[model samples]
Target chain A: GAGVSQSPSNKVTEKGKDVELRCDPISGHTALYWYRQRLGQGLEFLIYFQGNSAPDKSGLPSDRFSAERTGESVSTLTIQRTQQEDSAVYLCASSLTGAAANNQPQHFGDGTRLSIL
Target chain B: LAKTTQPISMDSYEGQEVNITCSHNNIATNDYITWYQQFPSQGPRFIIQGYKTKVTNEVASLFIPADRKSSTLSLPRVSLSDTAVYYCLVGVGLNDYKLSFGAGTTVTVRA
Candidate 1:
């Protein structure tokens, strides 16, 4: 409960279906990030939100992938018309400060494991 | 963003000191090096971070040489529970939010 919390730890869906993964960051963290980790691979950054500033969505793979953060409390990553390649562990992390501060480390949640069939 | 390279895997025994090295030849002046560990089904957990010189925390030690071109993550008296995938990331203060985490090194601690 103290750490970052993610919902629906596991989800299985059809290839054409849509799914939303939620993340609740630490109480006062101002920076939030979303990442995707495929099996036997490294994490791929999806999006980043720093306070109320515009989100950095450069890492988004396509138009179908989008994310949003409500202030600094909760964030959600959505995938529309998901494909089999969309299957992976969606991770959420939060930091006290944005990436501009190198010393601040990001705390991560266990993540939501999504399987697209 | 600087590119980082680490070993594919390593094997160590309990009570031994495991040192995993990462190379970042084109690191920038403002880039900081950070390490994270991940278990089978969990997100990465921060291990340690350093800009230059050496930094030590309860979980691990991060050693960065003067050139800042390479870093080593040292785990002392490692136990079987230390077995996991370790990632070395090279960017944080470069104003680049999308930090790259190349395929990490898998360290297996044996009894």
Candidate 2:
């Protein structure tokens, strides 16, 4: 089966600019998540979307970071007024279902490496 | 979410088995243990997951004792390609779906 797909494998932008990263979850996957990984650091959870439920934005570092998922298809993580600290690989993942209790492992996309100057 | 602890790194040779253990002393009854592998410039890939006892897949094996405070991921006869970062995560079914990943153990396989 095809895996989750992320666009703009690499993106370099100036500070204060806005950047949008895209993710295409696997077919039939009802849950999607976004994460950030700084160099030499573990992944930091960003946001999650489960079916029709309200997206979990608790992990968003600041108001500048936001994500939206349309139905169950695609998700876009937008960083407004990007800062140097926002430079990192943005990863997206999806599972067959949400609620984690079911033990469905998330499948991940390679991710988008964002660089801010 | 339960916090997990794992080694910083491990060194091994091709054909040798590698075992990375993770500790989650505060694991909840509903929490499950899962492992992920990531290569350079790639996203983490699920290796194996288990709630208790032992679970084995074509890629790796997960061993959890009755206490469930800790779990071990065993990769049998690893090859050079097995060199990657192995993350041990505990905390599923919380409906949060946000996995708290600590610095994973970097396994370097040398021929």
Candidate 3:
């Protein structure tokens, strides 16, 4: 894709249900990231992937929040047993490589607005 | 992660220059300052970054002082389309790309 792409721009799910958000990073970009933004709040880092290295999941809020990246292209963020508090916009970004990659700036997607009722 | 503090909101007018300042008292020596802009319903886009002194790009300019405890983002000739949330962040500039965004300064550019 020309830029980062996210699937299901919006998602409404019931409590206790599961949801998956997908992201397709720009071609040739070796770094990918996921973030969560609550209403009127700043973005919270969730995870990051650099090439074939193990993903850095230190920012995942809880056990219910998990993510996986396939190779260096597509990634998925899954939320288990959705709760009302989980409603927010999930954003995805990709850069040429992880930080200090010649000051490579991250490009973000439109994001998926997930709502749990 | 270095903790950053910025205004909750700001108001500006078209054709005027807007400057948003951020303070990071505990920033590490190896950290670099970066800024991002985000419109409603869209993801953040990187604007400018700098280590010290001044760095300017076509979209924005970043000014950092000698102390490195604070930095400023300057937007010249603002337009309504420039209305968006601006975020300032400090990172190690190392291989780790994890970002922790504080409550951004929402800039409302009116016509």
- Top-TM-score candidate index: 2
Worst 10 residues of 3 chain B by lDDT: B92-101
Clashes of each: 0, 2, 0
lDDT of 3 by residue, A1-117 (tens): 598999989999999999999999999998888999898777788888887454588888899998888877899999999999999999999888776564677788999999999
B6-92 in candidate 2: lDDT tens per residue? 999999999999999999999988787889999999999989999999999999999999999999999999999999999988876
Question: Candidate 1 overall Cα lDDT vs. reference?
Answer: 0.88
Best by lDDT: 2
Q: Compose the digit string of candidate 2's lDDT tens values, residues A34-57.
A: 999999887898888887454577
Superposition TM-score, candidate 1 onto the true structure: 0.91
Which regions of candidate 3 are displaced past 4 Å? A99-102
Per-model DockQ: 0.61, 0.64, 0.50
| Recovery fraction of native interface contacts for candidate 2 | 0.71
Q: Estimate, for each residue in B1-111, the C-alpha lDDT of model 1 and write its tens digit.
A: 678899999999999999999999999887888899988898888899899999999988999999999999999999999999899988776376665667799999999
DockQ of model 3 vs. true complex: 0.50
lDDT of 1 at B59: 86
Candidate that would win on DockQ: 2
- The TM-score of candidate 3 is 0.87
* Interface RMSD, model 3, angstroms: 2.5
